[model samples]
Target: MYGKAAICLTFVILFLVSCSIYIGTVDLRSYFFPLLQSPPVLRSLCATGRPLRVYMYDLPRKFHVGMLDRRSSEEAAPVTMENLPPWPSSSGIKRQHSVEYWLMASLLYDGQDEDEREAVRVSDPEKADAFFVPFFSSLSFNTHGHNMTDPETEIDRQLQVELLEFLQQSKDYQRSGGRDHVIPMTHPNAFRFLREQLNASILIVVDFGRYPKTMSSLRKDVVAPYVHVVDSFTDDDPLDPYESRATLLFFRGNTVRKDEGKIRVKLAKILAGSDDVHYEKSVATPKNIKMSTEGMRSSKFCLHPAGDTPSSCRLFDAIVSHCVPVIVSDKIELPYEDEIDYTEFSIFFSMKEALEPGYLVNHLRQFPKSRWVQMWKLLKNISRHYEFQYPPKKEDAVNMLWRQIKHKLPGVQLAVHRSRRLKVPDWWRRKR
Candidate 1:
């Protein structure tokens, strides 16, 4: 009997030990598995939940809004939200290239209700993810030298020289070698005086038509939309849009252009004499802009051939008007392309296809009415992404541009870190 009891005790001890081991294994897994999974989740939360912190340099008014008002250079005080000048109402087509002004004004805006902003202006350089250089390059080009040969062109040149001097003296610029700095040069010739000096920085440009591959590429630069010259079409909902629109295609602008834009001249010839088409050679007077607005609103599709550049403000105007755009540029770069698909709302044609007589209009003529209506609906839905205004709205052009900048930050950070210890810059290029 004693021997039997001892065997039972030994079995009980073994069972308890096995139970303890199983419980310990369960506890360990419960403690460590979450620790392993938390990193990526935490990182995603930090990245998506937070706004991009930007440090804007305290530039004098002359560099930005001061150009709008012709403020004196001796006014040394930095532009503030209270002192910031409104964009001139009379600024016609120039307003299309005013990305620099809006970006600077966004940073200056101190409204308490701007909780949805994608970028928040920070005073500390160390906390900033990027730096903004708010020189009004486009305005300077428009104001000082519409005619390049004028003596006042020297004023634009001097502004660029002064801007370079100011940036060179900043330690933040030296730290990243201007790789992290943002400069807006939206005009084709905005910073022509010293563009080479800024080749390393993140350029805010409209297109790569004028720039060499080395100076600007999609890998580093952001292609911003030109603020549409025509106003947005607010009441576009109709019972029978396809039937109500009388015209098949509409194009009203300069006919003669250079490079790939030469297709415009060919198109003007091919599209001539079509009763359903309105092709006019016109300048952007107030009356012409109004007429163009009306034409786009009533048209089934708007023709967007290349202008001086591969992309033009007319394409954006078509988008905001809820008019389906028939794009003809082969080398155009679009804004927010990472998230927005152009094929959903616009039609594409190769230059050769567009230039061919009858082929261009015949296809558009046979395009299904149901499909055209679908594209028009899509255009109306996505048009908000292109609007740029003060007290910037969520996901509008200004905020959208900041988000694009955010997308580039990871690549910028990788480059900035790699440059710090590398003995020879661009060694990978040399190896290739």
Candidate 2:
């Protein structure tokens, strides 16, 4: 019998195949900042003016087909997100190389094309500022039904060890001259590979911080620092603009897991009686909170009641999309609370105080779009700090790995995985 996780993964595959949830098509002219034809200009990147190249490598094995982000062919209009000035430097480096966002590359498990394999297996001893590894999965290596302690059978633990040790010991690996960084998802497997290839480099993890138990467990083994990008980062007083609508966006994970639908409905009634705060679309219950990141960004405000306690990504996504996060969960003990003011960045409604009839909406009505727009900019800047860098926000990842180049140890010898293997199998084998 498959465990709950395996069953869940199966469900995700089936549902995404059958149900098909999408944010909509992205046209290159608008969605992304740098136009494909032109080098995306960044005015505020480091003073060095070095273009950050992100190479996105493949998607997670389970959701590869359903994921729209991985389809490099899915074109979108140029994005205005990264406001940058065009460089006068030579066109070869500037125009030729696009940021190597890992999202663009095909997942190693997606296909067997030689080109794809080469792209996934590229050596980091040479060019490239960072090898992008978006969507980190540290605990995903549990495999089929077996766990860390389960009896081993057919597969070679060496492969597994390489991946896990890479994440653990290879915090100092560097590649591509002195400028580029070797980056991968925040998994024990990939991290191990990074360790084997690059050591002492910054190992960054970006994702929701809902899995406290799992995260707490992983933290003990952590060899590098990790950061998360929440869908919404709400403050104690989550205020909304007067003219803007008052509504919370949430894609369901499991409605049965909690009364998510009813919770949203109750909030809806409060906003409905008020002016201009009409709720649209029945409350959406997604199997994954990750799906709602973009949805929350599109909506005026996102509903963050914390699914079964203080588990919500609304706060991070809200700030990322320039939306407000209306948090209804009071059980959360957010990280870095002492450093950042939650009340200033996010709006919170205590579970006890939330359903007090019009209390939630009334507070939301107080926020104005103009004010939100300003707050949004502030949030975006703050988001950069929270945003889990594939290459890390600073130069530390590469620097961490770079320091190991002189190490006499075997871990950071800079031996790249040079063998050309099947693409889909590469991804699956790593996941296992």
Candidate 3:
């Protein structure tokens, strides 16, 4: 009887020990498992702590920094990290389209710290996730011909021709048929001569107002913010921000424009004779830009009407100025939409609502002071994301753009793979 009791007691002890071990593992897993498996959004944003590997083509300086100084292009040697020229201060409004320059500079950066970088230069084309064609097409258009009608425009056309020939000869470009190639044509008319030929590649553009849906769309292309021309409003803190800003609404830029921008002419007429509003006809010049800086700093809302395209640099300028932006574009596609919520900091009006005789001003006149202050605070918080600079800071414009490019890679790979084995033409395109 004692032996039987001893065996039963041993069995009971063994069962309790096994149960304790199982419970301990569950408790540990509850705390530790979440650390190992991060959320999808976090994983996408962090990129598993790896910088995007990019392979940039060794193109001639004439296509990029050389445009800043003709002498650089005349040299036989290509542009190097040590010899890259600074963008000319006299570049004027062209500075807005300088996204291409900053992006190239980001790849050239050879800092000792790699943990904070969003992209790294890779020498081997085989290891590159995406290929960068560092042709400053926007600078080419701005430099070779300010006026498209001028005979000098032929120079821009010839450069596009030469670039196509160079790209077609490359085995890397041929392998993906240019699908993985990144080309910046932020200016609407950049690469005008041969844009259709590069429809397969990834385009970095400011807007799709001019592009056909077939050539460029959000599915494949990346929309980058224009480099803000106005100086950042560094000391924007105020005890009563809404009360400190005297002007109710402000707008100062070209009144005459094309397509959707015609609304500016109509708005100018309606906003005329208002005591609190400061709508004026002006062009972008050194003096005017400085005046605009002061005007935006003291205004409750900065108006951003569509320019030649659905968006313009003015919106980004407003952001940096810490002025609440009143956006009036109907079909604008903003940069970093997946990650940034524009509505948090900006007010939007449909073209119809903006054009109404008294709807816009009346709405602003009644906009809650508390809400405007909230938006102003948010604007200041997110403004750094729009800034473009060298040795790019964390979460700055250049790094944000690289993150955007990484997001598009999965879609890029899918299209590239489908094309390789497809025996028939794309059925989706045929139906369209």
Candidate 4:
């Protein structure tokens, strides 16, 4: 009996220790959240405390990056370091891996109504084995309250209204294995980006919850085995996908537009100017398809600047390409801040700083290689481990919805253990 008691005590201690450890425990809550979800942001935690653990559902590391005219790999070119960033420095883990069992399912939201991304990833046109529900696109800029006269904002708001209405109109979800899966989006916060990703994962998604009168037209009325009730995501967080390569895009012209051509030109300049940087670029797509694992292996930062966007795909490409992004957008509304290591994980040059080319160049030139390297490694580890706290990308907003449902209809309890008091009474004989 004494031996058994000792063993149980040891086990209890181990359990408690594990519970207190947040390092590797994947927080499913963050997976669906982007940085903007909560206010009075989680900035200092990443810098001061035990790091925030995350399940990074990042893309495979070898997707070749090239100019738009020569965009995406062609499957024919010889992959070389000239085309890719430096390999992630040697913690010795391969970046190309799929955390198969832990993932509930992957979903993509283009926010442009462009199904091409989906079309490229999946094969079947009609039927499906594992399929993703794509949100057609984001609202126009004017609609988002950016500027009253901004037509784009107006369009953005209209889409939000329409999407919200669809959610409210729904009473319940479609019949899957005979269950009432639908839940109410009934609140204003329901449509936030992170919430969107959750919504996509949930079974019953009220399509018109935002539109009070239009709540009658929930889309699940037509589509299913209706996704009304979904199993909550398991916190099957994967290890980090360490990245150590950098890609710099330097723009030389003031006439550069926000379009792909301009972006590519800037990218080429950065790549061309780069030697210790190790990369290559071009003005073409489809043909520029190249992936040199070596180049990605040796480098560490992607010098990002918008030829013309308040934000651009270059940032996404950084996360996707597995390169630490050096951002230049100040007004950028990055989705999730708390879960990421953006504390200089990404570098931001305010508009004034970037405009002064000589000063910017000199500052970077003056930056100690050791300091830059340390910053790069720190961010690389975070990106590899933490799912960037980004706003829900299209369907990701659907993800945010599941969170709401889980909140509204809280689930059953899991294993609950009472805390054991560790007594050290002065009157007692010293156990030690």
| Winner by lDDT | 3
Which regions in candidate 3 have their CA more than 4 angstroms from the true location?
1-48, 423-432
lDDT of 1: 0.86
Candidate 2 residues 1-432, lDDT tens each? 569889999989977655543433433334353333121122121223223333433333222221223333324332222321122222221111111122233212233433212233333424433444432223223221134454531132443444444434433232222112333334323332224333333233222232234332222111222322334434322354323323433333333334332465555555564444434442334323345544554556656665433543434445565566677764555533323455656677787688797666666656666766665555655554344323232322222222221121122223222221223466687899
Error of 2 at 76 (Å): 34
Q: Which candidate achieves the best TM-score against the true structure?
A: 3
lDDT of 2: 0.38
| Displacement of the residue 377 alpha carbon in candidate 2, Å | 3.1
The per-residue C-alpha lDDT of model 4 at residue 198 equals: 31
TM-score of each: 0.86, 0.38, 0.87, 0.35
Between candidates 2 and 3, the one scoring higher on TM-score is 3
Worst 10 residues of 3 by lDDT: 37-46
For candidate 4, write residues 1-432 as lDDT tens digits. 999999999999888767755565655455545554432223322122221111212222121122112335555453232333232222121111111100112222123333311111133323221222222222112113444465544444454465445434433211121121332232222334334423422233222223333332222221111110111112312232222223332222233554422544444443444344443443313222123222333334555565443443345335433445666555443433333346455567765565553544556555665666555445443332223112223223223222222332222111001111344456565654
* Better candidate by lDDT, 1 or 4: 1
Counting clashing residue pairs in each candidate, in order, gives 0, 87, 0, 103
Per-candidate alpha-carbon RMSD to the true structure: 11.3, 21.5, 9.7, 19.7
Poorly placed runs, candidate 1 (over 4 Å)? 1-47, 71-73, 112-115, 423-432
lDDT of 4: 0.34
Clashes of 1: 0
Clashing pairs in 3: none
Better of 1 and 4 by TM-score: 1
**lDDT tens readout by residue for model 1, 195-298:** 98998889999999889777898888999999899989999888999988899999999888888888888888899999999999998988899899999999
- TM value for model 4: 0.35
